[model samples]
Target: MAAYSVADGAEVARQVATLPDGGSSDSLCAGAWLSAAGERQAFNDDFTLLAGTVPGPGNKGKTATAFSVSGGSPVSTGPGATASDDRAPVFQSGTSTLWYVTGDRHLTSRDLKQPSAAPADHGTAPGQSFLLAGDRPWVRAPLEVTPDQAAVAPGGTVAVGSNLLWRRTDPAASFAEQNVEPAVLGPSLNGRAPVPGSEAMPACAARLWFDDLSLLCNARNTLLRVTFAPDHSRVDKVETLIPEEQGLIPGAVLSPDGRSLAFLREWAGTVDLYRLDLSAGAAPVRIASLAAGAPTGSGGVGRDVRVIAWQ
Candidate 1:
């Protein structure tokens, strides 16, 4: 894999590592993120750096690893370091604490400072979740009492579900279900409806904007910006950044400044990366083509590329 600068799209660094299932020949079951200081933390089903001799056993599952952008030897947290699940391991951001779901479906956390120690069990894992940043940091998992997927704003207000926006300011508070009015499409696309028989998409892959007043989500094969009322009582607006006609967006990440979004889209057997400025009426600009081969996995819709992080 290679690291490129978002500013000029210049390749800055490249690391050759051997991934499980015959390197890149199989589905890339891996994820990575960069720290503010430019260090990369990543995980793979089984991985080995170019300098390493043996790859981790696939049966042991995903292994957590670390690398430096400046170039150096990579480090692995070792076998049994993480759960065998496909979900990417999430860091607390700016801390040594990491969070992941166990094979038994338990949400667990452990500190890198104590790598060999047992992880602290949090509870049953949610259907979907992400880190909620604040003075009191916590994992924004699905509500135990409800089936809806949830995303927590920086101020502690939670937005639940997709067909409708449900608001609950506190964990102990009751949710106020609110309807999300149809998106205000452009004149040429007015009155258009979702493809027939498509299931309602959830906001599980949403990123809380830096401002915290809105969420940038890739759902329904489109990019949307869901804005909330200042009081956090209801959703004030829902805007489509990129329409579904574009293609299947496997993943997206917000820029550090929250002014742009980078995502991976697969269309016509080709996967390409695109960046969009959040400005009004701005169009997406193609950055790179990730892959051009016969689609893999079921239904021939599996994505070969994924956006891990924007920073």
Candidate 2:
């Protein structure tokens, strides 16, 4: 096996705002940054969603956005201008669709038919947001929900912050949000709410990876494991990997078989990667380390672990 210098590994450990695929990537600084020209730019694999935040009147800082992309981008269909503030996008395999959560606390999805360059090539308008309740949909969604982060199980079930879990086996249903009783929720990341000095950590249900296990950022500042079974039983266990007094953020990836897990921890203003052997619940093994250099300031966000691969 090959190893890299700390400097080289740091250079390779680039912070990506978005990962469109294994080969290509995009950055919000370039695509989503607000310009003085009053136009917004959003980049996806095939289409770049752009909108002019219509100024004044009822529009103010929002407007009816339009979609555009390069010639080779994916073709969008299904919804109309119903989706706004698309972030943390993830694509389901073998489908002409893209799944993502909107800032409105609704898990809305878009359908793509082919790749394109200009936004007009995307045919569908957009879809309204869906309420995500626990395994059930209500005709009326939550009117007052604002989520900072979201994660999807491998099986496509969606989990939000520590307070709510939502799943829809069929698209015909509405997404619903089930408020988890906080009195009994903890011992794992999902069981606790964000404490002082750690508002950056994602909520328990929001930090999940794979189908059930998720990275749990606990009140003691430790990375742990949280699992939700089919019967809706919840289990919280210490990860025993990536130990930090300040805790691990919501940026962990499980190996394909769930035996090995990769996670990032920020300590003393530096960030590093650690691996754990889950076969016997071994402690985390440090693999690569990163520090924020003078030019590229570095820190972790809720969904910072965009991609991970092994030889």
Candidate 3:
């Protein structure tokens, strides 16, 4: 059966027997991958930063060496390491040193400063590694509202990129805050910006981020730049404009690093994916053509595009 009921108070219904670590299925050091959201979480190999694809193929009948992202760079964690299409990252609190992974069956964390050797089994299970060295989950809250985008901020704060909202767990109180006060860096948040009198969109899925004194946001179809005070007390929106339609998604995020972006565009009745090179300041570069169908009036009737980082 695809679905089955478990015993009362039990999470697992049936356990699939794990195969032994040899026969064409296991790779040495197989369970290490990383991620971050809205922030440039660098992927390091043996304490060295990885740019694009790194190495290692698992003993399993799979080319473990190939780690491709819809947008960013990736590094391999060895055998039994979980592969992920969604790679959102966050750093450990009280330290700017190590980074952690957010989305996956098991929440994973690693020290950026630690050499990229197969992480030791510091976790409670046999293969699981220590995510964040703490007594509890890194993010402990009352299952509050899901964030559209999140970034690890200074002073151990996870900054929700959209809505300019902030939330943190007060260790003394031992609970997560639901309604975090707003830093209010842009008008696009919550669609509070004045209605545009021009031919523009109503701004959906705004991407808000903080960097140094710069608070950046991408709204409607344009990127808005801003600045913040040292105290996180004052914020100002500077300017906004649409980026060139290169290899960038119109509504989804390509690369938060702003170095490169990937987008799905419709052409000849099919949705094709492309990558925009922000460094070139021109139209997007074509990475690969997505499958498309019959052509409509001018272009193919393709579905919208979606892109995500990988771990």
Candidate 3: residue 210 Cα off by (Å)? 7.1
Candidates' RMSD to native: 8.9, 10.1, 15.0
Output candidate 1 Cα RMSD: 8.9
**lDDT (Cα, 0-100) at 219 in candidate 1:** 66
Count of backbone clashes, every candidate in sequence: 0, 33, 25
Candidate 1: residue 160 lDDT (0-100): 36
lDDT of 1 by residue, 1-311 (tens): 55557766566765554334422211133221111111112322122222111123554544333332234344455435543442334445445555555556666665655768766766665433333232222334332312212344555554433232333434442212222332211121234333122223343344344456776655647876766567544456767788667577766777878788887777666777789898888898888665543245444554434465675
Q: What ranges in model 3 sit over 4 Å off?
A: 1-144, 167-179, 183-220, 241-258, 265-270, 277-288, 291-305
Best-to-worst order by lDDT is 1, 2, 3
CA lDDT of 197 in candidate 1? 23
Q: What TM-score does structure 1 among the candidates reach?
A: 0.57
Candidate 2 local Cα displacement, residue 71, angstroms: 16
- Candidate 2 lands at a TM-score of 0.48
- Provide TM-scores for the models: 0.57, 0.48, 0.39
Model-by-model lDDT, in order? 0.47, 0.36, 0.34
